[model samples]
Target: MEYAIALVVLAAVVLVIVVRPLLGSAGEADRTAELRAELEAAKEAKYREIRDAELDFRTGKLSQEDFRRTDRELRTQAIEILRRLDELD
Candidate 1:
């Protein structure tokens, strides 16, 4: 009976050791997925800002020089967001 109890305890320990990493990895995957989604949303928002800036330029709401500067800055930000998204992949 003592040997049986020891065997059961050993089995439980081995099971936990094997399963712990799988559970940890599942959490990691969820976090990565959440991060990817946030990055994608940011990318889309940046794209929308670029489009709005262009519309303002076309409508003469923005001066040529100011529009150019805004466009460059927006593009640079968009590129960085893209780079981060790529790293996640």
Candidate 2:
């Protein structure tokens, strides 16, 4: 009977040790905030590139064909980046 009581106590201690971390709330919020910031920065950079390309085209710095090609490329890149962000979420 005494050995059984000791065994139960030991089991209880081991259980607590193994389960404490699982019981606590993990740092999910911090990770989400970091991911959101990264997404926001990427979106801003993508838009900035598009705007710069448009301005250059308007100023006659790029021909119409070149502008259309660059516009397509930038839009495709932006879409891919957004798709990756969706996957992360």
Candidate 3:
């Protein structure tokens, strides 16, 4: 009887050990999806910022050189983030 109980206990432990990682993978998927969403949002925000800067330039709020510099920098950063997001998927 004691051996049977020990065997059952051992099985339960082993079962838990094996199943824990499988359950944890669901959380990993959720985290990946969340990261992807954030990356997309950031990319969109960068685009919007670039658009706003262009509008500012057109309205004479920003100088030509400043607009070009700001647009270039923002585009580079957006490209890098997009590459990273592509890698994750």
Candidate 4:
């Protein structure tokens, strides 16, 4: 009877060790989805900002140099956001 109990305990421990990682992976999936959504939203916002900056430059509101600098920065940031989204996918 004591040996049986020991065997059962060992089985339970093994089961937990195996199953815990599967459960942990599910949680990670949820977090990944949430973060991907956030990144996509940020990317859209950056694109919009870039468009607005372009309009401002065209309307003589921003100097050519300032516009180019801001647009380049926005493009770089947008690319990084997209890369992150791709990684999640």
Candidate 5:
């Protein structure tokens, strides 16, 4: 009886160990998807900011030097975000 009990316990433990990675990966996949969505949203927001800045420049609201600096900074930030997303992939 004791041997049977031990064997059952061992089997349970083995099952748990085997299944843990599968379960963990499901959660990991969800997190990765969420991260990708967030990254895309950020990209869209950055693009909108650039477009608005361009509109302001065209309307003569922003000085040429200021527009250039702002546009460069926005592009740099977008590039960094893409680099990070690449690393995650």
Candidate 6:
């Protein structure tokens, strides 16, 4: 009976060792997914800002120089976000 109990305890330990990583990976996957979603949202928001900036320029709300600078900055940010998203894949 003592031997049986020891065997059962060993099995439980082994099972935990194996299953713990699987559980941790599930959490990692969730975090990765959340990060991806956040990145995508940021990318879209950047695009919208670019569009809005263009509109403002056309409507004369922003000076040409201001628009160009804003456009360059927004594009750079969008590129970085895209790069991060690609890295996730």
Best by TM-score: 6
Model 6: lDDT to the true structure: 0.99
TM-score of each: 0.90, 0.66, 0.90, 0.83, 0.91, 0.94
Better of 2 and 3 by lDDT: 3
How high is the CA lDDT of each candidate model? 0.98, 0.90, 0.94, 0.95, 0.93, 0.99
Question: Local error of candidate 6 at 4, Å?
Answer: 2.5
The candidate 4 region of ten consecutive residues with least summed lDDT is: 80-89
Across 1-89, the per-residue lDDT of candidate 6 in tens digits comes to 99999999999999999999999999999999999999999999999999999999999999999999999999999999999999999
- lDDT tens readout by residue for model 2, 1-89: 99999999999999999987765535666776788788879988999999999999999999999999999999999998898788777
Worst window of 10 by summed lDDT in candidate 5: 80-89
Candidate 4 global TM-score: 0.83
After TM-score superposition, the amount by which residue 12's alpha carbon in candidate 5 deviates from its true location, in angstroms, is: 0.7
Clashes per prediction?
Answer: 0, 0, 0, 0, 0, 0
* Clash pairs, model 5 backbone: none
Residue pairs in candidate 1 whose N, alpha carbon or C atoms collide under 3 angstroms: none
Better of 3 and 5 by TM-score: 5
Q: Write the per-residue lDDT of candidate 4 for residues 1-89, one digit (tens) a residue.
A: 99999999999999999999999999999999899889988999999999999999999999999999999999999999999888886
Candidate 2 TM-score versus the reference: 0.66
User: Per-residue alpha-carbon lDDT of model 3 for 1-89, expressed as tens digits?
Assistant: 99999999999999999999999999999999999999999999999998999999999999999999998999999899899898997
Model 1, range 4-66, lDDT digits (tens) per residue?
A: 999999999999999999999999999999999999999999999999999999999999999
The true-versus-predicted C-alpha distance at residue 50 of model 2, in Å, is 0.3
